[model samples]
Target: MFGESSGRWLDSELWHACAGSMVQMPPLNSKVLYFPQGHAEHAHGGKVDFTTRIPSFIPCWLSGLKYMADSDTDEVFVKLSLTPLTQENTNALLMDLEDGGDDCGNNNGGVVEGGNQEKPASFAKTLTQSDANNGGGFSVPRYCAETIFPRLDYSADPPVQNIVAKDVHGNCWKFRHIYRGTPRRHLLTTGWSNFVSQKKLVAGDSIVFLRAKDGDLCVGIRRAKKVAVGGGEVSVSSVVEAVSCGVNGRPFEVVYYPRGSSPEFCVKASVVRDAMKVRWCSGMRFKMPFETEDSSRISWFMGTISSVQLLDPIHWPNSPWRLLQVVWDEPELLQHVKCKT
Candidate 1:
């Protein structure tokens, strides 16, 4: 294992280029809609069988929240504690939805508040074969090197300097930044290989570089999403446990690996309440925003709701899962969506 400093200097908020910035953190102490079936699709890679009954949707309160990063991959995740809303309140919301009323929203609604500041300079690059291989060096994009890295003393025979940066955990990393590759390009040597190995980065995975206003360089990563071989059972089992605990009104924790491209199960209550006012019916067309698979850009997908019925009405009555079947206009892109994952 690589050593990590037990200190912090870099602001975690500035390191959002990878995934955090793409989606807002569900507001704290707000209402959210938790969809177990939607969560299962991402966890098991596709549709899964569930012997135990799972609710279609659980109206929950965001009782607790904490952001975390995987020690190995540096992938950011948010841990959440959710408590189901009272069944009485849920029924009232359903009644309001059926009545097409929009006044059911409560005042406990808003995003988490944070002090604003000048955002830092950040660059993201998808690791190429040469960058992730055993080259002992990483090819840096000219723009990134020139714009984000410190001023290089090109006067020397081979413009090079020692660069010290910190990872998400505030662990310091050093590298030899040089502008002397074959094509007169920038490169990271001396300490690049160790970072690759320790982070277990691959060609498809991405590395994010950030330079705070105080000139502290920070390194973060977004691991490529892969259907883990032999690990589906484990993920599915854990998700099921969380859903069970949540549906029973018991507090449960969910660790959301942001890069997984999973549907935001715990969605802000304000947004959900707004959506609840929609007269959802068959043939209703709608568009929703999604992150590109590369996490490089935001895009929209338009679809039409084919039906509005519970996925399993008998066993999972009033469950919101699969309640709406939509056909996307861009059916081809449906198979692959964002995360570089």
Candidate 2:
């Protein structure tokens, strides 16, 4: 069923390369493709592997290619071309897409990359209304920033920072920051980290932490919007649904499986929040016991946070990331959604 699955499995690595940049010239004309995973039962032979599952090769003419991190392989590749536009314009295009949930070829309310020559005020108005009714807005309570960023080494490794803010309608909006630095892994401050544990974050889930109108930290989990497994087109409505339908309460995991290179070894994971130490800042450390399958049974691994990078807001300025903790879970599932046992 893996090969015949309708969606594409975007290389997480491509997400890293494309991170913080805006107005990407994708290798393909902003279209999705379908590729097969070597596992599941439909490979050319009964056996398959990551190298065997790399998506069809598409090269970018304008954008340079980069990977998410060292361990990433070609299977994580995403089609993106480098653009010659300013970081601001590039960011604008990206922010526009993420905000409006529209894709490159969207013409109904057609917004062009490197276009928008109209008055700045008009453009600003259009941009602000993009997600107005959707409860998207950006404003960080000074307490939230002081409480989170500094702890994440924002003072030292500052990359772009972003926060989720809300409007009178109880709608949450994301605010992103643009900063200078080589990208680093972002950490959730003590409060938000606890919040994640409270929410049981999975791979595709997006968590938004905001200062509630009542002046408290609140979190929202937006699942990673899925496209076709290997590659296929996704609709804007689907993206909006991903954001709008985000779970707004604490979550618990039913099973836990660490990330792996093989398929047979994979298992699902479920996490329920446990109150640990409170009031820790970003980058603060905590210990958790994780169980993984070595061969047949499970083994325990002591986990520590290696690093944390605040998602660049300029790119996704109005999206949320307050309690966004990107910690390493060995039994990490390849995708965020839980698979059936």
Candidate 3:
């Protein structure tokens, strides 16, 4: 039966050429042959099964020729074929339409390394405001809270394990545990489980921990289901915030980077040259081989600013992006949790 009850003939070339392969144009340079014989007895729904294959393609080709072709074929196969009359003619007419619409965006639709159009801006702004409005009040730097609680080593630790945490929006983040070797740092890392519980992370979520220059720890989330790179699983190698054991207990800071934020702010070469002198809580920052890709917009805490601000509109100004401040209780208590020297 090949998983189709409508009696509509399956088109393997139409689906494989468009949905199965990541290459958009299907490498027209090489010949492609799709045979109906492949699905004649496919009991598990075959290559032509609409249910399984359609959803898989949706995430892969979010916006490309494959996406376009799928949409067109779906319309004809699912709708026009049921028409009162001239169904064949209508289907033929639609197939004649050539593909277009690649000019308006990038390979991943609207994503371009450092580009933040609207979502990240809104998330950042919302977080900042909520944190400010909390009952215990927003989180301040460790230096500012010293009077309320005693300070710990706040040094960097080699990542013990890699974990993934995701937010409600379905974003994926790869996190590395840098608080290894001692019970104190373990407690601190364990405390992060609260975020996981509150956010309801399943087995596939991503959670990242970052240490900044002043010993402040930042938390980020990415849903597990959305992560597809490197076997679609979490690993310690993806950690960008690696620190030396000798640097442990010396103070560090945490910076939160949202998705789609922009490259101009993230990859400022001049700033990396003078990183030691910078002092800020969370804002535009860099990670990794800073010069490799020009499109990564970085977010972290640095400089003298107390809050994250919209770094002016470049790619999408009208729907401008901003940072979100998180509201948390007992910032002083969390700061008191000491780490071994």
Q: Which prediction has the highest TM-score against the true structure? A: 1
* lDDT per residue (tens digit) for residues 15-35 in model 3: 221111111222211111111
Predictions in order: lDDT: 0.69, 0.27, 0.24
TM-score of each: 0.76, 0.19, 0.19
Q: Alpha-carbon error at 330 in model 1, in Å?
A: 4.6
Candidate order (lDDT): 1, 2, 3
Taking the tens digit of each residue's C-alpha lDDT, what string does model 2 give over 80-174? 22222334543554444345433433222333232443211100001122122233332233333454322333464454455543322233444
Query: Candidate 2: where are CA atoms >4 Å away?
Result: 1-56, 62-164, 167-206, 210-220, 224-341
lDDT for model 3 comes to 0.24
Greater TM-score among 1 and 2 belongs to: 1
Whole-model alpha-carbon lDDT for candidate 1: 0.69
lDDT for 251 in candidate 1 is: 78
Q: Model 2: which ten-residue window has the lowest total lDDT?
A: 265-274
TM-score of 2: 0.19
lDDT (Cα, tens digit) per residue for candidate 1, span 1-341: 11122112224464355554566766577667788766776565555667776667777778876665555456565667888888887787667656666544544533253424555677788888889986568988877898788889989989999999878787889999998956798999999999888777788877888877777888887666643432112266677788778777887777565566555667765566566567789888978677654344677889998888877677678765555889889877766654344
The residue ranges of model 1 lying beyond 4 angstroms of the native Cα positions read: 1-16, 42-54, 87-109, 113-120, 153-158, 181-183, 212-215, 227-237, 279-288, 292-296, 301-339
